[model samples]
Target: MKKLLYAIAVSATIITGCGKDDEPTPTKVPVEGEITGDITANRTLAFGNYTLKGMVKIQSGVTLTIEAGSTITADKSNGEDGLVVLNGGKLIANGTSDNPIVLTEKSKVAGSWAGIIMYGDAPIVNSATAPAPQVATSEDGLSLTYGGSNAAHNGGSLKFVRIEYAGQVITTNNKEHNGFSFYSVGSGTVLENLVSYKGNDDGFEFYGGTVSGKNLISYGNSDDSFDWQDGWRGQENTNWFAYQTGIGNYGVEVETKGVNNAFWPKVTNITLKRAAGTVTEAQSEIQLDAFQFKANGNGEFSNVVIDGYINQTTPTAFTGGAVQIRDLVTYDNQVLTGKIKITNVKLNNTPTVFIT
Candidate 1:
């Protein structure tokens, strides 16, 4: 009787095990549609279309992975659409040259929306002596604090990305956004082959960071092409090209918030060009210089090519030059100390090489 009961139990176990194998596998659905609000957990965006609504923030301790060939369109109807990666957050957006990641607006107008803003815990010198690890509130009206002692902080990687028709004004105080804003990002972050096209404000602006960019293109921006402040020390930057059209200011604007420090950024293989019919911000303003160094700004630039800084409709007073040392203090301190250096310059159809 005991042996018969054991054989019956074995047969029942085999039947139950075979029933479990008949269940179907579950499938993963792709994420699509509008994206907004805060992201607190790790998320991956597949190669598809997405619309940005309001302000989308990637909070700390979270990683947002975007696959290649993804298109994120900004809905400027709200006028607050942008992507902000807070400190300690990571965004891995790596796209190939053939299939680049695109962030654009549907209206296709400049200043249509805010651009990509990232904050990292990198070293920065806002003042000569503020603190050991300098910190300051964001100027984009978010009022968030940033800056730290980590020089090798990794905010994540961005390659072969294109940002178009961004640079929205966030506050009534005239705090405008740039196409790409790196706030105190570190050297471990990767930025390469990025393009900022037809933005209203600056194409690329670094507010005190050690992150270097290579193969950067700023095309047809109304404001300055490349601008940096607060003692940025990107040591390995190369192949930067800027083509200004419509109305613009400087091709490259450098400043250090009046701090005369030993740190200086370095760049190589630069090209700055202004179209023939291009004008300045205002009819009376002659702010079309190719390179403007002010407020103790210092950098080492090599193999530069500047061309067509002349105005066609305006008189000689409105014409611009290749380089301008805006302040006497910067010229005396930074330039005289060999902190500001430019080598192997080639000028093509340039009215003046230096603005006095």
Candidate 2:
């Protein structure tokens, strides 16, 4: 039982209302039931082998604690969506590395089910309140309605979890779903030690929020490893170890819509390794653009390494940037040989050498 653990220590001084003088509180009243449709509760809700057919909605000021090793399977046979709506609620999914919480498709294959979709009412850019898009439904014909007043809303925490083989196709624009999709989530939410393996689309996607994360890994994904759209202001300390066996697309990508808003996403300590395909083609590692930041979007990358084989590509397509070359070492048919955007970078091998 391979384990991944995410330890979060929330600063009491930083968190509003959580005063140091306040005594430890006892557990609130528990709300136990078998949910088959939309679930809205103000207390703790637990699930078993039960299949959540529709949307499971958790209201504000409530705490939804999912026990370790509990599996919440969504019905995918129907055209419904499997969703968990947390509008002003807190989620404490504390799964240990050995007993991780698994969110998978009903189908056994690599890509079979829709992923978890979260929406809040916190403030969002260009809109005063939550954006009202078409509510997604569940496989059992339940409408998962969310997104209002709380646009940049905050939730609980997601630690030591594994979202496997998710991200099903829902629309035609290639808006395929993701393993864990966060829409209008606020700075209050914490995500740590999460693993998304073998998804159909993006492993983890964020629309808008003030998110901060650490120790995250994505394996064998079809699209980007970490994709951020809308306006995401977060800090990610990630170790992006991809499939040494050829699995997904780029390592990390940051894009925005226009320049009116700021898409200033800061990433530190990122390590991207090439997996399958040729090093060049499959390992085109990091892509950064100000699509959403427009004129105001300023992206920053520090202390990173992008080392792999340069699959035969046109010279015009082989341009590199940012990642330090000296701190990188290659294996097999791979080698570290050049310097990219540098604050302080070094190259160990001779300048003309191909093998390190």
Candidate 3:
């Protein structure tokens, strides 16, 4: 009987040891460090805190996947800091509403760092009658050219990503970067639920891209809240909201690099609001309009809501309007020709419809 009891006790001890061995290991926390250099292979950044030290480029044929709840602080004090997804590369940053991916600067001030820039091989129209699609050089000081014939090109996916205090000046001639600059990104790319907050320049600028943006928010940007150039023709853009504060120029500044094309961008369900004390970039009477169309910029915009775009100039030097045509050439060619279609616009606290 004693021998039998000893065998049973040993078996029970062995069973307990096996159970302990089956337990899962705890996930390790990542140490904080600066992220730089060109990513040549597939890499995944798990949930952690990181700093962007310099020009971090996700090179071609590589995929950089960032997990949700990651916080990347831009170390602007070090040097020119920015993230660039080159053409043929991918940046999959998919975050949830509960825990969004945040890229911000430590200074918490505008123009603190260069912002996120992505390049894709998307079709763009630069000449009025070019037989082939034309590409343009990037003005973000990256010294790169972008544009191609891949209308379905896919740069990557971005959701619930917030960029703060970006739009740093990168050129020696005083050209600043936007908060989110899309350079010829194609239709297969996914951009949604993104926020550009308190940038020194435009909140979101598309440079000849076919990728559409959905549920985008631009708040407190100094320049235009939404700006596009180089014949951007995104057809599925919707639900864009902009709130200009402190200093601002226009709610929407549209341009096509002085080219009037048959095809233009289409956007719906937009909201632009300005605080009462908002001032223009010039601090003068030149750029206080809600919507300014120039350089043959034409689009199909509908269901827009404009509010609080009051002219804050001293003694009210000029009359502000909900729509300001910068040149008579754009008015004659685009607006009169029905290329610039703006319908179902609702105004609240707006001074005029067209600035005379």
Give the candidate number with the greatest TM-score.
3
Worst 10 residues of 3 by lDDT: 1-10
Residue-by-residue lDDT tens digits, candidate 1, 238-326: 99989898878899999998999898999999999999888877667668989999999989999999998865466645768888888
Model 2, 223-247: lDDT tens digits are 7677765556665644443432244
TM, every model: 0.89, 0.65, 0.90
Q: Which ten residues in a row have the lowest lDDT in candidate 1?
A: 1-10
Collision count for each candidate, in order: 0, 20, 0
Candidate 1, residue 178: CA error in Å? 0.3
Clashing pairs in 3: none
For model 3, how does the per-residue alpha-carbon lDDT over 28-143 read when each residue is reduced to its tens digit? 67556568888899998888899888889999999999898889998678878999999999999998765678899998889989889999989887777667668888888887
Q: Name the better of 1 and 2 by TM-score.
A: 1
Tell me how far the alpha carbon of residue 39 in candidate 3 is from the true structure, in angstroms, after superposition: 1.0
Error of 2 at 8 (Å): 21
Cα displacement (Å) at residue 254, model 2? 1.2
TM-score ranking from best candidate downward: 3, 1, 2
